[model samples]
Target: MRLGIIGVGHLASALVKGVLRTGFLTAENIVLAPRGHSAQLRAQFGCTIAEDNAGLVNACDTVLLAVRPQDAVAAVSGLPWRSDQIVLSACAGVSIADLAPYVQAAQVVRIMPTIAAQFGESATLVYPALPQLAPLLAALGKSYELKSEDHFEVGSVSAAIFGWAQALIGASSDWSSDKGMDRAQARALIAQTFISAGTMVAKTDEPVSQLLDSLATPGGITEAGLKHLENTAAIEAWNGAADAALGKLEKRR
Candidate 1:
C-alpha cells in the first residue's frame, strides 16, 4: 500500500525505516511530508518529499499522522484529506474524537510504537482493533488491537517505559565501566541481558514473582541485589515515573 507520513520525526522515521527494511512498502511507494529531519530522511530512504500536508495526503491511500499531540489538530485541520484514506495517528494521547474533525477520514486508528520499530521489534498498539491495519502494524512489530481509546492511552503510557529502559541499561553500563570493564563490552553485555530478559518474559507464562523466586534463592547474589534495590526504592521510583507519564497522557483529550 502507498503510504504518506506527516511529521518526519525520530519515531516516524523509525517506522518508515522498519517498514522498508521488512519490504512491507518500497521507497517509491512512500511519500513524506517535510518537517523535522525530513531532508535527512528523504536522502536516506529515497522516499518522495511532499511540499505540504495536503500534497502528501493526496499522494497516498494511507496517511500516518505523527505530529506531536499539541500540533496534531492544527496540522491535520489544514490538510485536505480524502474520505477513503485510512488515517493512522501516532500522536500521543490524541484520541479519535480529537482527530476526527480535523482529518475527516472514514477510518481513523490511533497507534503507539517505540524506537524498537526501527528494527521491526516494537510492540505496536492500535486502537479500535481494525482488522485491515493489522498486517501493516504487525510488519513493524507485535501488533495489539485495543478495544477502546482508553486502552490505547494506557498502552501509550506503557510504551513510554522503553525510554526508561534504555536509561536503565545505560546506567548499568556506566556502573560496569566504572569498575574497569571495557565500556563497549559493558554496553553490549547489558543490551544482551535486556534482550534475554524480554525473551524470557515473553516466552514464559509464569508469574513474575515466581520467576523472581527461582532466581532470588536465600543468601544468593540475586537475593542480595533484590534487597539492595528494594532498600534503595528503585522499584518505587520506576512506578512513580510511570505514574507521571500516565498523568500527562491522561490530561490530553
Candidate 2:
C-alpha cells in the first residue's frame, strides 16, 4: 500500500515503527511529508519525504493526517484531495463534519491511541462517521466504532491521562528518592505496571470488579490499598475528568 503520512511526530513515529514491524506499509511504499510536520518520525521511519502534502497526496492511495489538532485545518485547507484517497486521522477534536468540506474523499476515520503503540500494545477507540472505513484502520490496532460523535470525547479525555501519568511518575520518583531508588527505575516500574494492567484488560472479558476480587483477598495488602484509594476520592476524580472532557467536546462541536 502506498501511504502518505502528513506529520511524523511522536505518535506518528510510533505508528510508522509499528506499521513497519506489522508489514502493513513499508518504507519504499510509504511517502512522508517534511520534518517541519513530523520531524522525529521522518528520521526514524527511513522513508522518502513527499516534498509537500500535495506531492504525497498525489503519490499515495492512503493518507493519514498525523498533525497536531490546531495545524490540521490550515495544513489541508488548500490541498486538492482525491476521491480515491482514504484518510485515517489521529487528530483529536477534529470531526468528520469539520473535515468534509476541505477534502474530496468521502471516507474519513478518527482514532484515539496511546503512546504504547510504539511497542504494538495500544488501546484505540475509533469514531468513524463512515462505517466503510472501519476495516481500513483495523490493522493499526484494536479499534471500536461508537454510535455517536460524543463517544470520541470520552476517548479524547481518556487519552489526556498521559499528562497526569507523567506527573504521577514524577511524584512517585520523588517519594522513592529517600529510599535511594532513582528516577529511571521508578519510571520503568510505573511503565511496566501500566502495560501489565492494560494487557490484563485486553485479554479478559470478565468484569473489572471480578478481576479486582481475584487479586484482593480478604485483609490483603492490595485490598487495603484499594480501600484507601477509594476513600481518597480517586473514583470521584476520574468521573469528574471524564465528565469534564465530555463537556469540552460538546463545546468544541
Candidate 3:
C-alpha cells in the first residue's frame, strides 16, 4: 500500500526508511509532500513527493501524520481525506477527539512510538479500535490495544516524558570528564554500557532481582554499586520521572 507521510522530519524519515528497507513499499508507491523537507525525503526514500497536502492525501491509501504536537490540529484540519483512506497519527499528547472534527475518515489509529523506529526497534504502543488496521500497527512494535483512553494517555506520557535518558547521560559524561576520560571514550563507554544492559534485559526471562543477586554475589563490587545507586535515590527518581510524564500527558487533553 502506498504510505503518504505529512511531515518529512526525523521520525517520518525513519518510517519511510523502515518501510522501504523492510520491503513494505516501493519507490513508485510512496508519496511525500509539499513541505520544506520534501526534497530531502524524496532523496532519502527515492519516492515521489507531493506538491501539496491535498496531493499527499490523494496519492496514498494510508496516511501517517508525523508532525509535532503543536502543528497537529492545524495540519490535520487542513487535509481532505477520502473515506477509503486509513489515518495513523504519531503526534503525542493529542487525542483522537482533537482530530475528529477535522477529517471524515472511517479508521484512525493512535500510535505512540519512539525514534528507535528508525532501526525497526521502536517501542510502539497502539490503541486501535478498528481490527483491520491492527496488523499494520503490530508491524511497528509490540502493539497494545488499550482498554481505555486513560491508559493510552499513560503510554503517551511514557513515550514523550522518557527523555530523561539525556539527563542521565549528561550527568555521567561530566563525571567521566572529572575522571580524566576524554569525551569520545566517555560517550562510547556510556553508550556501550546502556546497549549491553538493554540487551541483557531483552534476552533474559529471569527476574531482575535474581539476575542482580547473581551479579552482586553477596558483597561484590556490583552489590556495592547497587547499594550506592539505591542509597542515592537514582531508581526511585527515575520512577518519579515516568509518573510525572504520565501526569503531564493526562492533563494535555
Candidate 4:
C-alpha cells in the first residue's frame, strides 16, 4: 500500500525504517511530509518527499499521522482526504472523534507504537482494528486491538511503561556494573532477563500471579526482593504512575 506520513519525527522515522526493513512497503511507495526528519529519510531511503501535507495526503491511500498531540488536529486539517483513505494516528491522547471533523471522509484510527518498531519488536496498540492495516502493523511487531476507545486509552499507558522499563533496565545494569560485573555483560544480561520474563508471561496460559508464585518460591532470592518491593510499596507506586498517565490522557480528550 502507498503510505503517507504527515509527521516525520523520531517515532515516524523508526516506523519508516521498520516497514522498509520488512519490505512491507518500498521506499518508492512511501510519501513523507516535508518537516522534521523527512529530508533525512528521503535521502537515506529514496522515499518520496511531498511538497507539503496536502501533497502527501493526495499521493497515498493510507496516511500515518505522527505529529505532537497538540499539533495533530492542525496537521490533518484541510488535507485532501478521500473516502477510501485510512489515517493511522500515533498521537498520544488524541481520539478519533477529535480528528473526525478535520479528516473528512477518511477513517481515523488511533495507534500507539514505540521506538522498538525500529527492530520490528514494537507492541503496537490499535483501536477499532482495520483488517487492511494488519500486515503493516504486524511488520513492526505484535499488535493488540483494544475493544473500545476507553480501553485504548488505558492501553496507551504502555507507551510510557516502555520507557520506564528501559529506565529500570539501565539502572539495574548500572547496579550490576557497580558490583563488579562487566559493563557490557551487565547491560546485556539485564535487558535479556526482561525479555525472557515478558516472553514467559506472553507465551504461557497460566495466570501471571501463578507464574510469579512459582518463581518467587518461599525463602528464595526472588521472594526476598518481592518482600522488599512490597514493603516499599513499589507496586502501589507503579500503579499510581500509571493512574497519573491515564489522568493526563483523559484530560486531553
Best by lDDT: 4
lDDT of 4 by residue, 1-253 (tens): 9999999999999999999999989999999998999889988999999999998888999999999999999999998899999999999999999999999999999999999998999999998899999999998999999999999999999999999999999999999999999999999999999999999999999999999999998999999999999999999999999999999999999
List the candidate 3 regions with Cα displacement exceeding 4 Å.
Answer: 129-145
Q: lDDT (0-100) at residue 90 of candidate 4?
A: 97
Tens digit of lDDT per residue, candidate 1, span 135-183? 7887799988777788778778878898888899999999999999999
- Backbone clash pairs in model 2 (N, Cα, C under 3 Å; residues 3+ apart or in different chains), count: 1
In model 3, residue pairs whose N, Cα or C atoms come closer than 3 Å (at least 3 residues apart or on different chains), thus clashing, are none
Q: Give the per-residue Cα lDDT of candidate 4 at 57.
A: 88
Relative to the true structure, how large is the alpha-carbon lDDT of every model? 0.86, 0.74, 0.75, 0.95
Query: Against the correct fold, how does model 3 do in TM-score?
Result: 0.85
Root-mean-square deviation of every model: 1.3, 3.0, 2.7, 0.8
- Candidate 4 lands at a TM-score of 0.98
Please give the range of 10 consecutive residues that has the lowest summed lDDT in model 1: 127-136
Question: Where does model 2 exceed 4 Å of error?
Answer: 37-45, 129-139, 162-170, 182-186
Which lDDT value does model 4 have at 173? 100
Better of 3 and 4 by lDDT: 4
Choose the strongest candidate by TM-score: 4
Taking the tens digit of each residue's C-alpha lDDT, what string does model 2 give over 1-253?
6878887677777777767777766678878888653555556666878778888888987778888877877777777688877777788888878777787663677788776665665667777645554443455566666767776777677677766766766776677775787778877887777668767977999898899899999999999988998999987897887788667666765
Regions of candidate 4 where Cα sits further than 4 Å from its true position: none
Report the lDDT of model 3 for residue 36: 54
